[model samples]
Target: MFLGIDVGGTKMQFAVGVGEDVFVLNKVPTPSRYAELLQVVEEHCSEAEKRFEYAGKIVEMGIGIPGTFTKERVVWVPNIPCLEGQDLAGDLRTRLGAGVYLGNDAQLALAGEVWKGAGRENSNAILMSIGTGIGGAIMIGDRIVKGRRGAAGALGWLNLDASVPGDKNHGYLENYASGTGIAGVGETHVPPLSTYEIVAKAKEGDSFCRKTMDRAGHLIGAGLASVASVLDTEIIILSGGLSEAIETFKKPMLDSFIEYAAPGVEQVPIVKSELGNLSGAYGAVRLAMVRGDMWIG
Candidate 1:
């Protein structure tokens, strides 16, 4: 049996999968402290074992994180400031007593897509998650192409602005197009509704909400075009809470993407994700099944 754990910026999801069937083991709000996170994972592991027929110590466990895991299982999680360079897998193995694998959350989502979601069609694909921040993962022929230093799909470095040559991000793209970005847009307006609420309002014909999502969509398309021009992937799959408003945002986004895409890269399709929010956990579970797949392993 395998256990999958997805640790997001906001919450943590757990699941147990045997063969083709999976059981949503549990979901819990992620806490900040390292010890608290360990505690939660331990509880979930026990619960999953109880609910499922797997009795022996968790044979393999996979953790989908927001960033890369390097030597000694150190996790370089950026958004979750406190986890930077911590020995995540080693710690988990010690606490849980078995094999533990660590991987990027976005990469796991891509794996989920390829496994049973929208990305099943093509061998080469790009999966981007637009939410509190934007994340990307690249897969070629069923393999995630983690570049030297494991930063190939790190799109935050895609310079949208040439003026600030070294700027990690623009206040707009990082603070407007993302879930955190759109929420930052009206931080002082309408009581600071969440991106989910914003999309809900836009669906109800709220003009301001619609405009906010449209602009964000356009921004996202422009970025995606840049990626397409370079990689020329078969398709780009988008997911996250923001994608819920695809109806109101797709047109402008498509237009902007076409406007920015270079010549001859005409048919790179943009589509919604099929994995929903479980991609991360599913991907994590898949990662644990692979042997000798770790960095510096």
Candidate 2:
């Protein structure tokens, strides 16, 4: 058995994995302070130890962070500000009295796909996580791309419009295409519709919402086109809350991709995540399996 934690801006997900099956333990609101975050995680770990069948059978643990991290320290977590510069893996190890591994959430999500979901048969793949913010991860010949500072696939910052100034925090692509970005567009006309509601309205034949989603889909496709051209990815996987609207986004996005992508790149298959939101948790377990030492005691 293994423990996997996926940390997000709004919520934190916990799961336990045994063999090929992964079971979610619980979810909790993410804390804003570093100390509180640690306490919450420890509490959950204690509960899992006492309540779950795995108990003493658990071998290793893995945690997925939404931002950049190194072997021992979390270098930069923008959404969860308090996590920056903390030695999260080390602290968790001490608190749990077991080995803990850390990985970038997007990267680990892709790992989960490769291990048990969509990318299982592909050695070269790309994943775009498009929820509150956009994140990316690339697997080239089975090796995950991690740039010098472990920020290689920070796709949200991809500049689509050079003429206008971009947001220093969320970046250009995220400003117009992410879930928050989509909701921002809806706010002007619909007055408080969420991205999901906007997509629903579009599906229900609302022209205004439909057009809005089309534009966003086109933009997302353009960004994906650029990525495909550069990486020559075998497959592109989409995950996150907004990906549920793939039915609305697919055609326009594919059309836009055909318009902008390099010749053969446009043919690359784009698919939804098979593991859905749990991809990160499964990937966390894979991370532990690959990087952590087996517990013998």
Winning candidate number (TM-score): 2
Give the candidate number with the greatest lDDT.
2
Off by over 4 Å in 1: 54-57, 78-82, 148-151, 164-166, 169-172, 187-201, 204-209, 292-297
What TM-score would candidate 2 get against the native? 0.90
lDDT computed for candidate 2: 0.84
What is the clash count for each candidate, in the order shown?
A: 2, 0
Shift in Å, residue 106, candidate 2: 1.3
Q: Which segments of candidate 2 are over 4 A away from where they belong?
A: 50-57, 190-194, 292-297
TM-score, structure 1 vs. true:
0.84
Can you write out model 2's per-residue Cα lDDT over 1-297, one digit (the tens) per residue? 678899998899898877777778788899999999999988877777777764465568888888887778999987899999999988988887777888788988988898899898998999998888888888888877866656678888878999978677887888898888888988888367878888899999888889888988999899999988998899999998888888887888999988999989989989999999989988888877666431111
TM-score of each predicted structure versus truth: 0.84, 0.90
